[model samples]
Target: MNHPMVVGIDGSAHSSAAADWAAREAALRGVPLHLVHASPPLPGNAVPPPAADRLRHLGEQMLARTVADLGDRHPHLEMRGEQSDDSPATALLAAARTAGLLVVGTRGTGGFDALAVGSVALRMAMAAPCPVVLVPRQPAGAFGDGVPAARDVTQVVVGFDAHHPVSETADFAFSAAEARGAGLRVVMAWALPAESVSPRTPAVTEEDRATWEDQEVAQLSDALRAWREKYPRVTIRPDVVLLHPAEALLNASRGAQLLVVGRRTDPQAVDGRLGFVAHGVLHHARCPVAVVPHVD
Candidate 1:
């Protein structure tokens, strides 16, 4: 079965932007688009059947309008929408299982602006079976230039940790870059090793700092070598930052069309986890963010 690109809708500006982005992606990938809205089941049978029917009607109406609007925006693109009776996370996870990619908004109707990533979005980001992209409230980061209408870029930014590299993530980013005919910006953020900071070690000299920086640059190159060979046409930009991983990547994400990060999958665990860097970028980046799952 061919998996379609999926987006979660909640009638919010952010979700609307996400839906629009998903439509563009679906068109780019030449795949169908699926829009899903999850509504919690009403409390016990106390509510009359008509009341329940009205709620369902409202959801269906929203779905219909979204489908119609995007269909008009993307004429040849195949699209469909559905209203499901389940919590948002549950419905999204089910959709992700068969989706080529999943997209969500930074904040939904029920999300708190103070919170970077909402519960549902974060949950799906960490647990979705496929890549999850969190698009911001405003529609930005679409690449390409030229009036009347411009196209999104083939450019993508990805973060890597040299000590704990994940090939799945590297390949995913490369595949996306390759698919888009864009360049890949790879980032690896690091700090002086613990031993370098110990009291036993004298204050690091400029020479030492330079040496460490060189090592970091080498590490990034080595980590991305295979991917470079695999995608010779992808212009690779290697950056090594001496700052927090999250801070470094988030900084690099500026002006990038899409940012990709990795989330470890724990088969024995029920909860999801993301490093500070992934967590930071997901909630704060200006462009759309993609979280890929990896098993250690």
Candidate 2:
């Protein structure tokens, strides 16, 4: 049996959009969809028992409504809704333990209007046991139905670090592309050494830059060779950019259906902050971003 895809819900428009995206993906993978709503326990003497009960009821109502709506759209997709008494991050993480992929809104009801991503969403992306997909809200007046515009050319873009390639990350990207029947764009960014610009350093000519670019392209190809063999049907485009990783990824995400990046996880580390590249694209990527956790 295929592991179900889990999505967090909070009665917000953003969460609704996430649920929609998750439903489509779940259907594509021939897996069930699970919707989870977390209602934190009220503090002692913080609110009357009646109000607390009302809050819990509201949470259940939200989940039921979302599940019903999604079921109507995806008639054949199996789905289940649950309400938990733990914090948002805790409940979602627990659900993700047995899930193949976890999905969440980029921002929820807790964040400020100006914040691009919510604290809980960021935390989940960095620490979830399974790969997490952060779905951004549809832009105003862009997709009135909460669905993105269908593109003639579908593509999945992944940021590849040739220096430290992770097979798990590659696997996720290739699988996603294969499932969607979309082309995979493997992007690798490189920059000239800072010392090369020093006054005492010899001037680097155009030929030197060309050679460096060629080397980076070779590295990217070598890293993806095995993946290409494993997923023979996935059409791939290798892109080598002379820019920052975040910028390269954001640019490549213009018409992409999904953007994938890797995050290094340390079991012993207390902090779960995301890496610079993952953080940047999570905030500005035009399409859904998937953060795949791996141990380097």
Candidate 3:
């Protein structure tokens, strides 16, 4: 049978939180948990030494301890951990390729000198082979804070952008919400361009802006009209707010149990994919963010 969730972990507090979340999710799904940790290889020019053996030994110890902790807490879970000489993102991406789901902490056991997920998570969410969940280790209130334990609620808030293909995310969010008997909120955000500043006229005109706003509203309505029809039994609140798409969605996600977004691989991007707003939410959204990659 396939593993339900494959999680990438290091000993950091953030990673521990991710493992906890993943393990709990696995238990909920009645599947196994595959825990992984990765280390970089020695420089090509460097000489190999027997002393390096201790580093691999420590990795095994860390993995063993993590698995033990998880096993103790969840006796029914099938758990295992592995250490790789590859980069964290690479190893986790590979693990994600086949797993039913992939989970990672927004931050990791990296240098104290740098920030987490602000960059690395961006890369993985955009290119990972399967759906990726970036769990925020900090409290649920903000980017860096830790949330106190609450009931394990499973409501899902899905972000919709005209550029994103929403059908798959909608299906996932709906099923997860229904399975947990949780509410679902479908959100759309729109922002109008600033009024043209003219020295000749002191008055700002809402004419052009109104037209743009109307178009946006129409598009959003059209996007969800069919979905609302199909999922009538599901309580979905469709929202429209004036702000950056990323900010609007992130704010809506504050009370959500899960936030879902899509991964866009724009041919114009450096990595050849990654939508602007989706990228921002993946790196900064307060809750765990799921990126449903475009399959076609």
Candidate 4:
């Protein structure tokens, strides 16, 4: 079942931007927007007895204010607010089970520098049950203070691994593009064959390079064949790049509405949850980044 888009707000500039970003996305998806704020009760003896009430009260006010602001801006979009006592990550993760997409700030009240993507964002990106979008503190012109023309943001860039492409991720990208009448650019990064990269190997010939490129192109085509059939109306641009996957995606994301990447849902993994490529893009991508987890 489709679920409402959820955003976590903490009365910070980044989270405020996240709320606005979520409002726009909810409007695009034609779904409800749920505003959630987590103000975990302080440990005993840490503050005045009334501090918990004050914190919760503050969170409620923030939620109310956000709801009112977004309600005025997006008349057709449904909006509601709630406060959770769980940690930010815990609160959002539980909400994720019922959310189609979880939106969060690149940082929260804790991040001092503009470039710092906080721990909660990292945790949710790795463990959320649904797709998660990390809206940066400083967003693009379209996602900035003024609501620019949506048509100006024309593309959703998705990184695809031809050998083991994730269908859910591909579909997510297609759906996002379709929602905005934007194009989908599927990017694949490859390198030289093992034989060519080995020590003492002769320099690759033009014929071998041509063969490799053709093979990579074919792989990309085959990987996306079903998606193309499913989303015939969505314009698809398949990009096979020679750069590292993260760098290639970062470069492609310059003018995109969103960069979509996949996280492996491996139960046994202890750390490095988002993986190298995804983690890199999340840290560096210029546009909003979506981390869609898949059972790879």
Candidate 5:
């Protein structure tokens, strides 16, 4: 059996939007949908027993309601729910171990109102074993009314680094595009060498800039050759831009249904922080962002 698509729920509007997105995704993938709600333990005397009990009860009720609502919408899809005493990140990380895809809202209930991405969502994107999809809340009436707007024409945008290509990241993007029957937009950004830009150095002519851009285009095409064969059905659009990686990706995400980027997992790196490009895209990309972890 395929691993289920797991999503963290916390009775927040963002989480509700995430659940809706996950339900549609689970149905598309023909896999089970697992909902998790975390109610972390409080310090001694932080809350009275009765109050804690009430909180737990409310969490359970929220889980049941979400499950039931999704079931009603996706009657044929397999669904289940779990309430964990662990913190949100801990619970979701454990769930990700056995999940095909882990999903969560961009901002949950506990975070500051101004935060575009919540702490738990960021942590999961960096540390989860599987691909993490962070769904941002859509405009009012975008969901929960009826059918979502058709996304058939919307492409799946993925940031590609030809110099350090990660197969897992490309594979995930290709598969996602294939599943959605959408085109794949591969964005690669490049800049002029620092030395070439210095005043002491000879001015780089238009021909030189064109040659460098061509090289980047060629490298990007070469990197995507295998993925093209793997997912022939997905129309590929290679975009080599003269802009920052984050800016290029954010621009491509304007009408995209999903934006995919890589998070290099360094075993020795104790920080466990997302790479610069991924972090920036996650903060500003309007579309749902998928952070696929891979070893460089």
Candidate 6:
């Protein structure tokens, strides 16, 4: 449809906010906004009876209302609305295949619980055809009486694993930073082994603690040096603590607007297993996370 942004809309207030945001983004980018509402189909074995007919009618009404409401606010925008019989996640992905960006609400009116990322949002983010923006549900009257400010900066805080290539992540992170006119922070977290700490020793000698700390900082410096040019404005931060990388990132994200991580490139042994660190952060990080698939 040549839309710059494709946004999924349900009846939730969060969805309305997302539509508003998408409409503004489209206007800024000088492109059309495509609105989609997907409805799951009835069982294939079921007959096309009165109940099935009623369900279809309801779906149409919902789509119509959503389009009308959003269109009212953005009368100058070129908006296209559609209702289709497909799972919400699948349908949105299909519609976004040709879009420049996809915007989704963190929660929806669907039966799924809204603690973390909604299922559809997560699925689309993991395998979307383009970049996806996950917007949280703001409090009542948050976007009242005026349009909120546009996000001029897109903070991409990347967690680089020691064994992984920092250059790949840094490349993409810099692109995002430059595109949004934001500064990038390249972070390296070092996990101290339990063996390093002694139960009997109350105060360790300065020489001993300094030895371990130096090694950790040196490793982080080497990584930063390799990608120094890509992000000249990048801030290098190192953490040497007794915590898992995933847990450390979750806490570090308090100051970040977006968290960036690379897709696992670990070779699955005969058993075929993925890296636990990537899985952990993806499912639990408080802020929206961007998983950059391996560069071919």
In order, the Cα lDDT scores of the candidates are 0.83, 0.88, 0.74, 0.86, 0.88, 0.65
> Which has the better TM-score: candidate 4, or candidate 5?
5
The residue ranges of model 3 lying beyond 4 angstroms of the native Cα positions read: 1-3, 44-48, 112-119, 139-154, 162-165, 192-222, 225-233, 266-272
Candidate 5: where are CA atoms >4 Å away?
A: 139-153, 200-202, 268-271
TM-score of each: 0.90, 0.93, 0.78, 0.92, 0.92, 0.66
Tens digits of per-residue lDDT for model 2 on 28-120?
Answer: 999999999999879898989999999999999889999999999999999999899999999999999999999999989887988889998
Candidate 2 scores a C-alpha RMSD against the true structure in Å of 2.8
> In candidate 1, which residue pairs get closer than 3 Å at backbone N, Cα or C atoms, i.e. clash?
143-152, 143-153, 246-277
- Model 3 lDDT, residue 279, Cα: 71
State the lDDT at 20 in candidate 6: 74
Query: Which ranges in model 4 have alpha carbons more than 4 Å from their true place?
Result: 141-152, 198-200, 267-272
Q: Give the worst 10-residue stretch by lDDT in candidate 4.
A: 143-152
Better of 1 and 6 by lDDT: 1
lDDT of 3 by residue, 60-171 (tens): 8988999999999999998888898888878887887778788887877654535547455666776676777888875344434355434333558888765454687777
The TM-score, computed over Cα atoms with residue i paired to residue i, of candidate 2 is: 0.93
Measured with C-alpha atoms, the lDDT of residue 208 in candidate 3 is: 70
Error of 3 at 64 (Å): 1.5
TM-score order of candidates, top first: 2, 5, 4, 1, 3, 6
Ranked by lDDT, the better of candidates 2 and 6 is 2
- What lDDT, from 0 to 1, does candidate 6 have? 0.65
List the pairs of residues colliding in candidate 4.
none
- How many pairs of residues collide in each model? 3, 0, 7, 0, 0, 0
Can you list the residue pairs that collide in candidate 3?
138-145, 139-145, 139-146, 139-147, 264-274, 265-273, 266-273
For model 2, the run of ten residues with the poorest summed lDDT: 139-148
Q: Give the per-residue lDDT of model 4 (tens digit) for 146-222.
A: 65534335788999999988888988999999888999989999998877855676688888888998999999998
